[model samples]
Target chain A: MTTGQRIDTVFTLFVRLLLAGIFAFAAYMKLRNPAAAQAFAESIQGFKLLDPLQHHHLTVLATFAVPWLEILCAAFLILGFWTRAASFAMLGAMGVFIWAISTVIERGMNLQCGCFGEFSFPCGDTIGMCHLVRNSILAAGCLYLVIRGGGRVSIDRLLISGKPKVERLGATPTPTPTPTPSATPTRPVSSRPASDDTPIALDPVRPTPLSSSPSGVDAAQPPKPRWD
Target chain B: MRFVGRVALILILATVAATVHSLYWPIYRDLPDRQARTQRAPVTDAAAQDGSPTPTGRSELPEHYISVARAYQFWEEGMPFVDARTAAERVVGTIDGAIHLETRNFIDGSATRLLEELDRAFPVIVFCGGGECDASENVAIRLSGWGFNEIYVMHEGYDAWKDAGYPTEAVGGG
Candidate 1:
């Protein structure tokens, strides 16, 4: 590999490892006191994005989901598995967290941020500033992955034999084929477009109508076709 | 080899610095104890012996209930009404002339100096969002322990005062 590429690889690896360690520690801290974490969740005024679930149920789910997501993304980042995807997910989560925190601070909420569960860190004015700074750095790191494609040593690179493959599945496949009778003998439809219009128009009569049949003689004759 | 190692080293050092900086702040600071010494009802028995403000011989002190009318009276009389609600709740609405003292620091003794400044005999009413909230009660209890005898818990708090046609104010500034 070129010298610049190798430098980039090393830099990316260091960031991934550092992010992984921080997330792992944060997850552990949150798991320690889920109750306090839940309370902190409720204390925020308008962070009811997960309000589809009942209050405590949402709280419990968040208590588990947030940390686990952090840990999983961190792990993915370190392992370089779907590096860009993982980084994007981590960035999204951090954005939501930053918004939640900023809202709390802007509204002047004095509740503890459950970043480290029951561990009370005084979130004075300085704490908000510090949170923004830290999260912004993490976001920048994630953005680097999104922009530069997961650097070397990533599973994306290793699994694809050095060639990055982009898969595209544009439209859904058609369901089933139904027989469509011709409007006239010469005009036969080959490929029907799958729009709103119906394809089939059944013929009303045959050349030899059913009334001419032997069985038709024994029974009451059927009415002649309107077109005929 | 040297370049890669140097980059790795820098990354590690940066990570360590961030982590250390985040955790290095002092855990908690002890603010001065604000419980008023003179406000405490003089316990005759305790006064006869060691001259601490500790209540003596009184089985139970009266349940200090400061009604909405009384809160209004205090506000009219120029007594500062301290709202013990979280800052967010205060923004929605609060008692006029009430100073915002967050519940977190109310029990932490941060308000000790403020308490010390007030006349021991002067009335200090603590209130929260409403009766459902325990912040006012908690603040009242802490103030009582601080030996403030005239401490009153505005039972219904801001809600009751607002309902009783008393004036309300917007919370901001600090």
Candidate 2:
């Protein structure tokens, strides 16, 4: 690989690592023991997302589900296993977090963010706009992963490396494209119809294809089935 | 189908893992109303008087939750109330004679001298900013850890106390 390609790989790896590390530590803090879990439950209660009396079952479910899901998805991120799916789950979680934070802010409630257990950084001690911004940024990263998969250094990439491409029934023939982490914009071929592709990158790291293709994405293939 | 299905699968895995862990793990395995049940106050004065932690064998103690009416009754009986809400919340008014010893006070070690002043054997009444607030419960837990024999949390909070027309004084003459 060229110097640029190697750097890109390392950068992709770094993004995955950040996602894994932050989420894992956050999950561990909230799940270290029963007291920690109880504290987290109280934090969830503080948000008053659901009336503790009216939505008792849902409140309880969120208390148990949030941290456990975080830990599980963080493990997936670390292993790069089902990378997009894991990221999609986290992205959904961040949406809930953002909504919860906004609700508390709207209610003018100063709440303790039990986000990283007792550790609150970058957003101060209370849940506020800063916390919302932080969650938004993390959500963006998750969206990127959902769109781009986990990149070349990921298990997602490794799994797809030598697999045969699954093109749509009516797509035109083209050369098999290399498995680059990003959409090879300048180096595209027949996978996507020529007029239907975006030649520019969306993120600093990579751009999501406007449409998703099955595994073993050869940039050269015709436009295949999309998420849409 | 594959992408969405995989995401659903991740969620399923998370839910299953949480169910298993919550059901099986001793910590999470405790009853749901554990906060009310788990009082860590010293079993007896022997260990407390010795200036040593004696958290062992606390099964006999009852839940620390007390209704607002009961709290008022305790106030009439001369039990000192502890305000566990933040300074801003307390500025409006507090249970007359209630001392401000919020959770942050304990965390920052500022509540130490005040804690020293209160008798460990006293059945202290703690309250917070009211509904959905756990500050009082948190302070009660800390007090329990400090060997305070009976620490009751008024979960309905200070608002309920005031709404009931109970005797309340300005926290700082406000």
Candidate 3:
């Protein structure tokens, strides 16, 4: 493999591993206290997303679901199975997280994020900018995968055999064109056509002018006053 | 993938599960619901300027008795000590000069006619057994209900008084 390709492969692997580790840790912390998880959800002020989950069971369910999704995505990415799909899922989760945090901050609710619970590194009421920065970096990585597709060592690549079929060489002869001006323009229409095949003309015809005869006497004007 | 990471993950999961279990386990287990049943009364500040009787009615004593050196001080001041324990328990130990009012009859005021005969202003130090006893507080509450204003629960109770080598007596059949 070329040096550039090798570097790209290494970078992709590193991103996948980093995402997996982060998600796994986050899931573990949340699974600990479902109440704290519920509180964290309530702290994200917009739309009252947690209102319906005010009950204990629903709250616990939400706590489980979020972390479960994170873990599943992380596992998929780590195993290099459906790498692009997993990365996209992670990206989506991160977007929701960012929105939730921003909403919480905007609404001015003081609460622990429960991201790490009591084991949180620097003690504070809210999850600080560090969490956002970390998630943003992870998000960028996921977006990269979304665009670039999975790199070497991915199961997706292995499962799908050789290189994608290229246009067949020397088969299906290129047609020699007989240029005809048959009223249909060759240029593709930039704007949507009014009808399926008909091309609209640029210029249109104007109406005829009146004749200047003395008998006609310019109906309304009356020969422009004698002073003229 | 490393051995250390695997071990760390296991340890973390175990610790988290244990903590969660501990916090919630009591809810399901038949543990005593102390917070619900037993109310801790606010301790009266010693230096408070008010000579008015500290509002003892608001407090809820956990057991029939409470350890009270203050009630002992009251006893030293020539106040009569009232033993509110059952006749059976009184046989074990009781304070000297303490009148016997068994747990049931004391709070019900079966001895009301006898008590009413005494001077209303005389200080009465009420107590039962150790700090776990609520009988003292119950008697005190009953006395307060019966128009006895100077009722004080000997928080330490008769047991502590006897333990301190201060005084003791056996009353009734015991």
Candidate 4:
């Protein structure tokens, strides 16, 4: 890989890990303490989004479900497994937050945002434009992930085709055939590590054929005499 | 959009998971019991020692709710009116003799001393902005939590009282 490509890979990994860690920690804070969930419910109640008097069931459901969803999506993002799906889920969650906060602001309601479930480290009891801006920024990060899969060095990449290490400087191998529906399922003998154990139906990356002769010599070269 | 579709799927899956977990383990098993019940009248013997507000006047409030007319009757008889509205809302106008006790004050323990000063036997008429406004209920809950036995929430609240041309007071002279 070129130096630029390597740097890009590292940056992508950093963003992915940072976002995933934030989500996972947020989820853990809510799930760890039962009182946190209650506090979270009360915070939700303050928003009056779901009236505790009328939509008690919905309020209860949201209080319990939101954190678990965060945990699920964060785990997927961290592993780079279904990264697109996880990022999309987080984006959706951020959208809900933005809407809720907007409603509060529009109505001039003083409410505490339960964005991080029960973890209210930065935001004490105030919910305002800052909370909206924070969630919008996080949503933007998720949008980036959605657009640019999991980048390089991800479980998706590993599950797809992993390029085998080159044994010699000049040696080149023939490209593997693309898996076809009509073709018989025969395991090709390969110097590259085979993904026989992976049950997922995904295509591996194929090597491009070189124009030079396969005999480790140019077709234009003349035979050379050597004393044996 | 694909993103919207994906979010829908996540919400569905999360809802299912949460529901199953709740059904099996029950999340709110530890929440304080909210069911309302009339407590056997407070023991007078302990009230003498702790300086607790002695239950006097009426034995106990017949019901948790009282109509505006009933509240007015209580008002005429000098019952304390607790305004559950925010300070900003209170600036406009309020029932005469209403004491401002916001939900925030209750949560922060600022209202504790004030509540302690009130007589527990006298029915405290709590009212807010009325019509779908839940402040009155929330404040009433806190009053009950603070050991106030005879609590009455005015169903019509301040707005209705003002509309009816009842005696009202404002922050600044009008």
Give the candidate order by descending DockQ: 2, 4, 1, 3
Relative to the true structure, candidate 1 reaches a TM of 0.41
- Consecutive 10-residue window with the lowest summed lDDT within model 1 chain A: A164-173
Estimated TM-score for each candidate? 0.41, 0.63, 0.39, 0.56
**lDDT: which is higher, 2 or 4?**
2
Highest TM-score scorer: 2
Q: lDDT tens digits, residues B147-173, model 2?
A: 676667787888888898989898675
Candidate 4 docking category? acceptable
Model 4 TM-score on a 0 to 1 scale: 0.56
Task: Please tell me how candidate 1 rates in CAPRI terms.
Answer: incorrect
What is the C-alpha lDDT profile of model 3 across A110-136, one tens digit per residue? 344555533455435345566667667
Candidate 1, overall lDDT?
A: 0.54
lDDT by residue (A157-192, candidate 1, tens digit) is: 666532212111212222223222243242222232
* Candidate 1: residue B101 lDDT (0-100): 70
Q: Against the true two-chain complex, what DockQ does each candidate achieve? A: 0.02, 0.29, 0.02, 0.25
lDDT string, candidate 3, B15-125, tens digits: 454445434522100001212223433224541353434433333443323345556666677777778665656668677677776424532347677577655465576
Lowest-sum lDDT 10-residue window in model 2 chain A: A194-203
